[model samples]
Target: MKKIIRGWVLVFIFYMSMGTVYGTNTEALMTEKAFINELLKVSKTGAVLLTGSDEILTREKAATLIVNYLGYEAIAKKQNNLFKDVTSSQGEISLVSQLGLMNGLGSGLFQPNGKVTVSQGSLIINRIKNKLETPITWKHAFYAIQSSSQKEWIKGYDAISFGWSQLERDANNNFIISTSNTENDFKVPVGFEGPIDLAKANGVETYLMVYFENKGMLAKSFLEDELQRASVINQLVSLSQGMTKDGVTRAFDGVTIDFEQFLSSDLKELYNIFIKELKSALQKEGKKLNVAVQPTLYFKGYDYKGIGEAADHIILMAHDYGAITLTEVERQAGITTTPLTPIKEVYDALYEAGLSISDKSKIALQFSFASLQWQSQNNQVINSRAYTPSYDKIEARLSLSGSMKHFDHYLQSTYATYEENGIQNIIWYEDINSIHSKIDLAKLMGITSVSYWRLGIIPEAFNPLR
Candidate 1:
């Protein structure tokens, strides 16, 4: 029912926008009236007085109308002059131009007094409407910097988290550093800092991701022990202060905690306290804190409200839905494929989190680039076993069996089934289209930040710069 209302609202908005630039006729005047009335009904802050449809709109007026319609009038009023030709509406001109809603005439001239054509007026109105619908203006990336093209994608993100550190505990339950997968001696590798420098130079914030990906995760115990948690927090704060690179000490803007242990709801308070203390510690060192959290759809341990208030950002790892949560009966009955990140599941997770976390801006939705494959024999899933296959391997499997990919509208994902010898392999993964669909949903929900799982596995054509 809510979706039906939303659809009608979109249709109404489109109808109203068409009246913004109507012909100078009695019918056009009626449409202009309807537009104004509809705009007033939808606008939270009262209606804006738009010029009559017959009146010629100047570029300055068009920009002002756009900024005002989007409720960015205050922000526009604060902008300084970007064009010498305009002064009275310079702020509006600058604001709209910066937002890509309008543009200058050329050669540092805004031509503020120039007439706005009907097409130009309609375009500006549509752009403003789009901005109001999806206000995403920032992006985040979880990077490994494994390939050269991976580094190239760095230009697209507002921030990047590199897995440069690992957290561990010794026999005494004391905090310690483990040898990083990317480098030995638990140090940032040489030449690896180049991406850091490049990211920083591009005005992109950098974060050191402190990971605990042990097969038998010791993180739960370490976090449960207050003393050990404090010790780890101190270590993380120190790392955030700076790392040695090329004879100079450079610091990341923040630290990201990626502890992969499943914390049950019983530990929710403890986990919230841990996050608060870690954030407080990092704050003392002038660094920010980011926590990667499993989606509440699967894990009820995370206190979204508490964590949202304490940390600068909380990345909801929204993938892996239905990956291993199959029932015994279903396993025996045989399954063709399981969705990795079902759209409805992701929606439910976000909606549940929104109930507790009032500030959605602090939330970053995660998208995975990996694929999960399951083996089937005799029309039954074998042991219900599933494993992640590389992109190349998935492609080769498809090529070998000549299996075509099918789009599952229900899941908003793509899947393929292939025969390997006598066994059937079913693969489910995100493609460019699926990722874009998720992104569209995220933006429609007013989410501004999105984080990729990692760099190398993402498609070559994927662009994060939107």
Candidate 2:
């Protein structure tokens, strides 16, 4: 049975190769424990179990095996304690409870003696590909596995083998894998290459030291970089969260407070402090300090007016016309009304606050590539539920026949609506269709510059920022 299964797998690979599906090189060496650890890191739910094998190798067992083999006995014990803490706190079982790669199997019960099936192996690899925060690189390659005659004749065996064989390729494509395997090995590989050469090649042994700076898991370095600027903005707003926009704007204008006191009462004070330190550090690194302030309409009637005096440019958040509440006309038109009023309001408030925001060229109007769904029953606000309109929901609502056609129409219609509504400044969320529409719209609107809500959320396709 096993021989027959292996034969079928071989045939499938042959067919795949002929079909030009087998392309990536799979010969990169990675340790089993590292591979498993990565898999757990990338799993969507933080839990991945070994499947495809006849024997059940739970996540717990896999983790235990990794800890024991890696000689992390003390760390393993700590992991067990962490697991207990997480389980007790969450009142649910989560893969994060276990510190090791295979979940929380513990020190003594990893069950390395059990056989792994093809399905189980695929699940593990897939989890790794999905969960790792770092990038991976994938190279296509043909894979073949030999099965013994005594093994069960399972169709899934070929599927599983093919699946595991693709892990290296997937990781490589994402720029995560330092190596891959073209041939089979019972052991795992280690030390895969990363996209960021400084960190990947710097011999930085610990993720904690390189990124978190000893704060450990309590601080998320990746998120910090991505959100630091936004955090500063949020902090500024939060400092006067309870005050009316007009009052806050006024306060910002005349308040004789230092930068520290400026951010003292905000929920995001730490972020503001971090930004100050970051600016100093960047200056030392020979980077210029360019700060841009984008004011929202919520500050129209607030205290601080001359807020843009300290920065390079003042961006006006010109969208969100339909944010607080939408009118019946907006609902029928399938778009927000003119955002000009709010934009002008914010501009006026900035001027009133005494910011030296010069000509219009220094101010850019921000637009939205996304839309909101107003949940209304019979045209009257039904419970005032609003949702971000997604492609799938828009298609379903329009009863479009196919995803491609629906997406095409949706993109065209959305862009037209924005243009027709006379929205000049725009910033798009990180989405392919939205980005494409913004490009086309920019050409139509004759706008020269655009910005993104974030750099991280932007897809790899737009990484070059053409």
Candidate 3:
């Protein structure tokens, strides 16, 4: 059964995003004990959250029941009372103490019943991550940054104007990054001219990101062994560092690695090592380094603290707050085609991420303005596609689809239904209102910089001076 905890996630995504841009096949690629620590941390607040499980764990005793699941031999061998106040069952306090993942404050008074502080929580997680097995093989140079067809440029607005209409003239001196291909293997194809032309024509920078996926994976295998992994990343960095020399790229300009939703927890150490090493190499060449990662997963013990500290800028891919369903199972479970980037969803996800990630100055929340098109039969969706309708296209569709203009105040996005020959078509899209939500979200989060997926989707009128 799908864990359809609909409406549980309010800060943005952290909502159940169950499908693709219309269930397009995409392969990809996270740890365990640290999760218990998170639950323990959350339990301290006494905030009872109801998921599917009926037990609301606000008490430490209930939280300690998970320690027996660790299956440690030392747990059974315990014959001594380590603390006077410890009351957890299954020898959890003993095992945690033996593992050196936790400690007492003073005089052998183990605060098993006490609330976990940030420092204590960090120590526990770091200890667990440090012991994770690592014997990974370096992936061979099997992938290349191959370009695909250029995005259809809308006339009159130009590429830059399509990004955000409120964008000042000075902001156009920066790069506008977007992905290409079938959403599986995001690579830099041959002669796809968006960032390059902008870089050459306006002296803006171009950051060509390259990645591959087998349904979210690191080259179809877990990439471990930091030394060998560094070699592979070094090659990619080596190519990227000198990749855009012909475009007259300026300082604080280089490749932005958009490899989010692909890395597993066991591979995070290697991933961090790769970024740290890559940043070092890029810095030596006076090139800037930026990495794109999801804020929700960053808290799952994936080592954002290391990556954020290493990269020049961290592009928080904060969009995709909700999801569009594709499969029969998802649709059957009350999955609706909703906003691509709901403002409240973003705020909630970011709020959770902000608990772990420091230094908001380095973050540039990547705002999205896209929607999904679904065609349903007998109240069930049969097929769907990611539809990014331009202003004129939206107008034509509205006239063709219907004029009700239904709005989801929670999502802060609009959707409409129309009957084309008695077939129901649902079009959920972004308008100027979506952009306003994004601008408000950025300010609320105390973030400064913002990046658009492509320079031509929305328009320049919405982008404010910054």
Give the top-scoring candidate (lDDT): 1
lDDT of 3 by residue, 310-414 (tens): 976666676765555456676544345567766445655555445446886676666655667766666766564445456556567777535446655545566
Model number with the top TM-score: 1
Name the lDDT of candidate 1.
Answer: 0.70
Ranking by lDDT: 1, 3, 2
* Model 3 stretches with alpha carbons more than 4 Å out: 1-203, 214-222, 244-252, 297-301, 326-337, 377-392, 399-401, 456-466
The residue-level lDDT of candidate 3 at 416 comes to: 70
**What does the lDDT come to for candidate 3?**
0.48
Q: Positional deviation of 375 in candidate 2, in angstroms?
A: 3.4
Comparing 1 with 3 on lDDT, the higher-scoring candidate is 1
**Per-residue lDDT of candidate 2, residues 1-466 (tens digit):** 9999999899777654333232652222233444455444442311224223223444444444433322223222322233432323121122223311334356533333333343454555554343333221111110112222111221111101111111111332221111124453311122111111222233211110000111232223322444544443333333212212222211111000111112112223333444455344434433322222333224221113233333222334333444545566665554432222231232233333223344323333333335444333333433233545543444453453322221222112231112112322111122454334333222222222333322212233433313
> Which residue pairs in candidate 1 have backbone atoms (N, alpha carbon, C) closer than 3 angstroms, thus clashing?
none
Candidate 1 clash total? 0
Write down the lDDT of every candidate, Cα atoms only: 0.70, 0.30, 0.48
What tens digits encode model 1's per-residue C-alpha lDDT throughout 1-466? 9999999889766655444434532111123333333334432222235544545466776666655544445456557799989978787788678666687878899988776545555565565456446745657887764644578788888888887677765667577755244443234666767888889889999998877653434546666788788777777777778776577677899998876645567657878888999898888878898998887756767888998999888898888775654456766677656787776677666666666778889888888877777777776677555777887777776686468777665466778887767887778887775676566556545676788878877776566644
Where model 2 places Cα greater than 4 Å from the true spot, the runs are 1-285, 290-292, 300-316, 324-356, 359-369, 395-447, 455-466
Between 2 and 3, whose TM-score is larger? 3
In terms of lDDT, the poorest run of 10 residues in model 1 is 25-34
As for lDDT, the candidate ahead, 2 or 3, is 3
